[model samples]
Target: MSGQPNRKFDLALTGRRGGNVWTIDGEPYPDANPLSVQPGDHVRVHMVNHSPVVHPMHLHGHFFQVGDAVQDTVLVPQHMGEVTFDFIADNPGDWLFHCHNLYHLDAGMARVITYVQ
Candidate 1:
């Protein structure tokens, strides 16, 4: 396990059928509030999938520890299933977090993790 997460966020992964729009925490991509942290902070994200399809959640610029392994992405299954992972925010910048599915990414299943100054 990496550094223990001091900051935590719970996100709800959702989607709209008719329009094929994807969302995180009820907000779509650009509209979703960025997860903010400071350098050296350990962060954990609890992701809950509410949609009917699977979403491979990817994080840029950081690899997170889930259980015994470290990875940059993890698959989140449908039907309200959840996954939790933690990462150290040692990099200072705006990093993207999104669904690996190209269609879902295009549909707005994304947000940013920002390192505060």
Candidate 2:
């Protein structure tokens, strides 16, 4: 086993009418909960739309790549597709991840990701 640890974390978010209910390891993170991350880690966000409609996802501060070095404001089509994106946790800060729907944000469909020092 390598002394240096390579960690992979999966974040699952559900898209609904109001907002997203996020679960990390099957537990809900309360509103305004501090999102802590570490450097040299890989993050995989598996966004699933449980709603009858579609939602577009965005990750702020960190421009991510999906299969290639392309900027994506991806729309998760209803009941069909799941958009997956990965990023290297290089920058450290409180970053926002949420749906691009204005009303959805108004409805509280947002969360913060914080990289610890």
Candidate 3:
């Protein structure tokens, strides 16, 4: 990660919606599982959108590198479009990762990023 040797991880996720219920990897809201990593570890998440609506993916509390830009949010086009972002877990805490669309978030497309010691 940027030539700094520490720790790293990779994750894959999928976005889907059904009957007003939006989900990440088939689980909705608080029910969706967290991706566990430690402080200072580099984490990469690749998201695939299978839903009909576009998802502006967001990560709380930390900025991530997506393509050539560093951003807190990235847009994943619908219908199999995919996006990959990487970040160093400098802020150690539980955080939310989800779609930024109000309706989509309210409909339950969210997951937690749990930082473990």
Candidate 4:
């Protein structure tokens, strides 16, 4: 956990009513832009939830500091204006970041964080 981030990302979480689709920053999983970082970079993510359901966002391979706590998963309440967190990119690999809700995950609410040399 660090006070300043070398890179930052702003994401909007949304879902289509009655449709089997979910999106992040207007793009569905496998299509969402990959978050790229160097191994030592400090990263920050700002998320806004527009859907009507809570989204427990999970990140694999890294734990982020939210306020005073560190966690791998954070609950983004429905209609929340924003939530932000930061993490150090110590792991050098492609990692998954997604909504933990199974249906949402299956519906394409996911993206990848890639660490590059």
Across 65-99, the per-residue lDDT of candidate 3 in tens digits comes to 97789999999888778887788989988999888
lDDT of 4 by residue, 26-115 (tens): 798887789899988989999999988888999999999999999999999897657899999998999999999888988999999998
Q: How close is candidate 2 to the true structure, as a TM-score?
A: 0.71
lDDT of 2 at 114: 81
lDDT of 1 by residue, 30-54 (tens): 8888999999888889999999888
Worst 10 residues of 3 by lDDT: 4-13
lDDT of 1 at 29: 83
TM-score of 1: 0.93
Query: What local lDDT does model 2 show for residue 112?
Result: 79
**Which stretches in model 4 have alpha-carbon errors above 4 Å?**
none
Task: For each of the candidates, give the backbone clash count.
Answer: 0, 0, 0, 0
Clashes of 2: 0
Compared with the true structure, all predictions reach lDDT values of 0.90, 0.61, 0.78, 0.90
Could you tell which candidate, 1 or 3, scores higher by lDDT?
A: 1
**Which of the two, 2 or 3, has more TM-score?**
3
Instruction: Please give, for residues 48-93, the per-residue lDDT of candidate 2 as tens digits.
Output: 6655667777778776666665564677676656777676678887
Q: What lDDT would candidate 1 get against the real structure?
A: 0.90
